[model samples]
Target chain A: MIRHSLREALLSLWRNRFMNLVASFTIAVSLLVLGLFLLLAHNLRSVVAAVGSQVTVSVYLRGDATEEQRDRLMDSLRGRAEIEGTEYLSPQAALEKFQRLFPTMREVAGELEENPLPASVEIRIAEGHRDPDSLRQLAEEMKRLPGVDDADFDLPWVTRLRDMVAMARAAGVSLGGVVGLAAILTIASVIRMTIYARQQEIEIMRLVGATRTYIAAPFLLESSLLGILGGVLSLGALYAIHRHLAASQGGLVPVLRDLLTTSFLPRSTSTLLLLLGLAAGALGGLLSLRKISL
Target chain B: MVELYHVNKDYGRGNHALVDVNMAIEKGDFVFLTGASGAGKTTLLRLLFREEIATSGKILVDGMNVSTLSAFRVPTLRRRLGIVFQDFKLLSRRTVFENVAMVMEVTGVPRRQQRVKTYTVLEMLGLNHRVRSYPLELSGGEQQRVAIARALVNEPALLLADEPTGNLDPNLSWDIMTLFKTINIRGTTVLVATHDKDLITRMGKKVLTLDCGRLITH
Candidate 1:
């Protein structure tokens, strides 16, 4: 009998080809938009995190500071708990790197025979001190050192970048929340229509002594199948869209293929979609049955 | 067996569909519930099938208080009762064979037994040749016959048929009633709700008469 009910459901769906098409298409489109936002949020988060890891504060040497004074200043900065490690870029080493990076800069360097480039210490802060307020306080402490000419910390840009990342995150979360709500509502509406279309049939089934579960099982299976199929198709669509965008803009969005890339809906997420579809269908069934007597 | 103790089914404050109706039928007995339009004939049948709970008092079917049966247990109660509706209620998309087989299938009869029983019942009803025909393809009388076949396929302990012959010719009505009589003789208690006084009087079964939702005579 269960098989018969399933067969009946599928056959009916097949017979109503137009309705089935409409329902599936609505589900697919809603999921696609949702997937697109999810992919965007995932890639943006990766890029921001990568950029945040690479920024460091550079503190230049004092004019009267000797080599020993510079060494002491470096040690003092390194001794601080927030400073991870320090790299000393002497004037000569800085000039050599510039010469190698831009051969044309060698002639420019020779013109300034004294090698005007200042000896700077590149201070790498522990990740815990990556926040703007902490970096500013650390730079102030280092500026008080004996040999430090003036501490030059790219503090403002770091703060701006953090704010931008935060804004992106908020935007992503908000977009996801809105689209997810729309997707769920779309599923609910379509399932409701499906139930309404079969209201008469359900009434007859109840009158004929079918149990609540018996009357509801087939509809639940039908809606869940649609949702699972939509979720899978959304995963594939998101991946395809991600691949297309990555090929077009790989330079800007290098993290397009990160851990959270649009691939198959994670097993847990797809399972959730399936359950949500079933729940939507079950809710419709229950509402339709509320006043009906068996 | 069936018993209704002061069965009062009121739809609302002022509208009474059945009022203080008391009745009883013994095991293995056949009865006709007779009344005119708005006479609560269908209401009485609905009460027996547990389709509508009585507003007050109790209805017992086969020693079970049908009025107290929960929605979950209604199907179990219905499994022992066969009901033939006036409109046949055959699924329009299904063939006659499927319509008959559904009843047995719902009752959890094994597939092989369902096939055997359905075919035998169809053959008995002279519908073997039309088993593959959909309800829409069959005549009114033939559809009613299929409905009867479905109702009897499970060999229900009690049969409640509502206007079984309303859509049939006199000859077909007699034929269908004769089939009901045979099934009743085989120990299936039958209660038929109908307005055809001529047919009920001719059949001479114990008739319970109703007027304005009250038992007028018996």
Candidate 2:
């Protein structure tokens, strides 16, 4: 029965190649749009994670601070419950770190008469205390220390980044849902047309006592094949677009290079997309069959 | 074997397709249902196969009550019987072999068995040489024979044909009747519905006549 149904589905697809191709292309375009949003959401999530993990408050010391005041500040920072850890950098060490980070500025630093960079202590916040309010309170308290010149953290920027990630995710989900529904409807209409064309054959089959399942199996399989084909086509198009953007050297490529470093969809996600395609096709086939009394 | 008791089929709005039609055919009997157009000959045959359930009656075919048969069980009942039509109802896209083999395929017959059974039936119907030809490529008589082969490939217990020769010439129609007679001789009960009184008189079989949805003679 499976072999027979498979043959029937393949034959039907071939006979109505033009219409099936149109349907498949429509599905492909829909999936492609959804895939693009998913890719954007994935990259945003990665950015949020990377930025959040590196969040810290930096406290610069006064140039004229005494050794005793510096020691006292270090002790106070260590005693704070919200502080995960702290690393102190001397004036010369800070200069060296700055040069390493900004290689193009190394020559300018070498021409300086003396080290002008500030000595600072970097404070890593504990996971539970990393919220904007808590970090602001910690920074304000540090700024009141005797040897601390200023204490600052990019809490607002991090918070904004998180919001952007959330928005991207929500938009991706909503758009994907709408596009997926459209794809299913397209497939259903295509199958309906095919059923109409083969009405005579179907009537003959019914007259000869073909079971409902036997008659419907080939159509169900055909829809699923269309969905799977569309999925593969979308994946191919996505990969091609990704390759083009990754290889381009001008325009927004350089500006967005940091975010574009993100990899393609993971294997698990790609597999899930394929399954979604199959489910949508199957659902469309079922919807088309509802009105048919076979 | 078939039996109809008080068979009543009513199309809504004062249209009664069959009225209190009571009849019976013993096992292995060959019978003809003769009537003018719209006289319920097709309706009676359809009722036997549960295509249109009788408004109020009991239909028994091969010991199964078809009048009360559930929707899902209709296919099971139909598998035990073969039905041919005036138009032949052959799939134009499929070859003669596939058309005939389709019956066994629907009933879940094994592929190897389907091939053997399909070939044997075609050979029996004298259509062996036309197996590879499409329906449109065959003559009217050949197409009808292919339809008959499809109906008989499964070796049904009963065969019901509705105006099977309506589109064929007199010679071709006679040939089809002879084919049915041969099938009857091989022990398959046959019930044919037709309006050709001349063919009926020539065949000399038990005849059941219908007039205005009422069985008038037997």
Candidate 3:
């Protein structure tokens, strides 16, 4: 019976193409606003993920530390929280790594009689626990160890990037919430006006003995359909924005080294858009139902 | 069956719509409720349909106390009754077929069954050819016929017509009154509220006259 009512409602909407178009237009505009924020939220997450993965906090060893003390320091660093992987690089290994990175630096090393570099324990923090404050605390704690002279984060750019990403995430969530609420209100009012215009028809149906559910089904279905269409339109708009961003500001997204880096909308975000559209439509229908009678 | 016992309807501010109206209508009986303008004829119909509650009296239709009927269950009571409006209240946007089929649709009739029943009713009214036509495109008589078709499609146990012929010419008015007669003959109780003296007198049937909200005769 409910399904039949839905079919009837959709049929009624289809019959009034102009009215349906007006309704769809309202829904589409709301969805565009919603999708824009969703894209921001999604990109913020990706940016955070990229920067977090690249963050590595390295601990420098004391210049005169004994091999045993260095090994102990390595064990202690390994046991610490947020430590990804640790490598105890001997002064020669450090030199070799430096030489490998800059072949021209080998001549400078060759000119010096004594190796000036210190043997260091390089620590990488796990992506999940890579918070700036937490990493800074961990580094300080490691430096306090008897064999460790100082702690150095290999990636100096991570501090600013982490802060920027955090700010972006906060802003994105805030914008997303505001835009989502606006979308709901927009759809609700549109549906409300539509229901108001048809109040007479509804009253007639009520007088003619139509059930509340019978009258509500069509409106609910229409709302849902509107939401779905809005969702699709939002997704399309979001995608277009993403493509334009990637073209105009391709390098804005960090870690562009890997070709896998993309500003595309996430699968979850797209699914959310679809669900949001449907939910908006359903909610709009309910809102209109509450205000109008059968 | 319908019965109104000492029904007094007051709309606040000392305005009385129906004053102690007492009347009784038997099952499958036909009746004309005659009165001039503002004589409580429409109000009487509204009371029977449970559209308005009598302030102080017992009103029962088909053994259900309408005066005490809750708003929620009003639709159920209405389902057993068919109402014809003066304006022919057909949804002008819908085709004649859809307009008539809506009643059966409300009753949860399947599409196929509704189609068959609607076609049968339209055929009976000799409107089978105009089934696909919109109500606005139809003449006044045809529109009235469509309204009648909608009211009768559900096979309601009770039928209420409120000034059904107000907009019709004499011939069309007679035709509509005859349509009501044919429906009443099919074992459906019919109550027509109209000021058409000639049409009412010619049909005879039981007459319930209202004078300024008071039941003058039954």
Candidate 4:
């Protein structure tokens, strides 16, 4: 019975070509826009995490501060709980690291006959406490410590990047939600029209002893197929667009490359797109059930 | 194999379609229901087929209560009966063979057997060469024959037809009657609703006449 119904549904899809095309167009467009938004959101989130993880505070110690004072500062930093972890970089390690960054400056550093770099406590703050206000408060508290000479961070730029990421997320969700609903309505309307065209056939089927389940099965099958097909088309389009952008080699390319190593949709995200497309189609079919059985 | 006891059908505003209608049809009997327009011939047939429930009554066809049948079971009851309409109601998009073989499809008959049985039935109805023709391409008489073929393809125990010849010419109508006679001879109970008094008298079958939703004679 299911086989026959499936055959009938496939036939219906072919017979109602124009209506099916209309439905597929709407679904594809809707899913494509939603996919693009999610893809951008994924990249944005990666950037935010990358920036968030880079926030580290180095507290420079005074040249004359006692060992007890250093111990007291280290213990206070550990007890604050805002710190993820800390590493003590002595004057020698700091000089070596600076030389590693600028290899040509090694002779200049040796000519000084003394390490000019300060012995500092490098603090990796917890992700949640890395906001501008909290970091400022932490830096102020650190400057008052007995062994601390200075505490500083690039707060202006980091604060701007965080605010921008939050705004982009809100905008993506709002725009994607509105368009997705419109696409679902389009699918439902198209299915409704196709079913209406076959009203006479359904009535005749009933007269010939067809159960209601048999009569309604074909419509459901057709709608679900349309949905999944639309999803595939959307994914294909997104891939093509991503490829185009990747090939351009413009100012955006380096930043995009730095943030995202692969194309827009990762394996997991593409799977989610497929499942979402299927759900939209199923929901549209369900909405039109009462009309078809009429 | 059908029984109706005190069946009444009301169509809102106190318009009764069938009132206190009691009747019985024995197995293998040929029965005719006659009345003028709006006298409830269609409604009575509708009730027997479970298309509509009676306001107050009991209807048993083939040992199942029609009035109490669930929505899904309506198809099961219909599977054991054949019904033809004046409009033919044949699917215009499908070929004669597809339309005729659809009953077997509903019963889950294998594909090979469906073809064989459909071919045999169409050939018996003198529609062998027209098997590939669509319903719109066939003549009125031929269309009516295809409808009959579809109804009988399942070899049901009973057949109910509402004005099966109302759209055909006089000669075609007589031919259809002969076809029904041959079916009745093969031991299937047949019930037809029509108002052609001349044809009714000539056939001399069991006639049930209705007047104003009331059964006047049997």
TM-score (chain B) of candidate 2: 0.99
Best candidate, DockQ: 2
- Candidates' TM-scores? 0.81, 0.84, 0.82, 0.84
Best of the two (2, 4) by DockQ: 2
Q: Is candidate 2 or candidate 3 better by lDDT?
A: 2
Model 3: per-residue Cα lDDT over A64-150, one tens digit each: 788888877776765655777877788999888999999987899889898888888777788767766777888888888887788
What is the lDDT for A203 in model 3?
73
Task: Give the per-residue lDDT of model 2 (tens digit) for B1-218.
Answer: 89989989999999999999999998888999998899999999998887888899888999999988998998999999999999999999889999999898888888899999999999999999999999999999999999999989888999999999999999999999999999999999999999998888999999999999999997
- Sort all candidates by DockQ, best to worst: 2, 4, 3, 1
At residue A197, what lDDT does model 4 achieve? Answer: 84
TM-score of chain A of 2: 0.75
TM-score of chain A of each: 0.71, 0.75, 0.77, 0.77
Two-chain DockQ for each candidate model: 0.34, 0.69, 0.58, 0.59
- lDDT for residue B150 in candidate 1, whole number 0-100: 86
Worst 10-residue lDDT window for candidate 3 chain B reads: B46-55
Better of 1 and 3 by DockQ: 3
Write one digit per residue (lDDT tens) for candidate 3, span B1-218. 99888999888998899998888889989999999999999988998888777889999998888888887789888888889999988887889999998887787889999999999999999899999999999999999999888888888899999999999999999988888888888899999999989988899888988888888886
Q: Using lDDT as the measure, what is the rank order of every candidate, best first?
A: 2, 4, 3, 1
lDDT of 1 by residue, B120-150 (tens): 9999889999999999999888999998888
On lDDT, the candidate that comes out on top is: 2
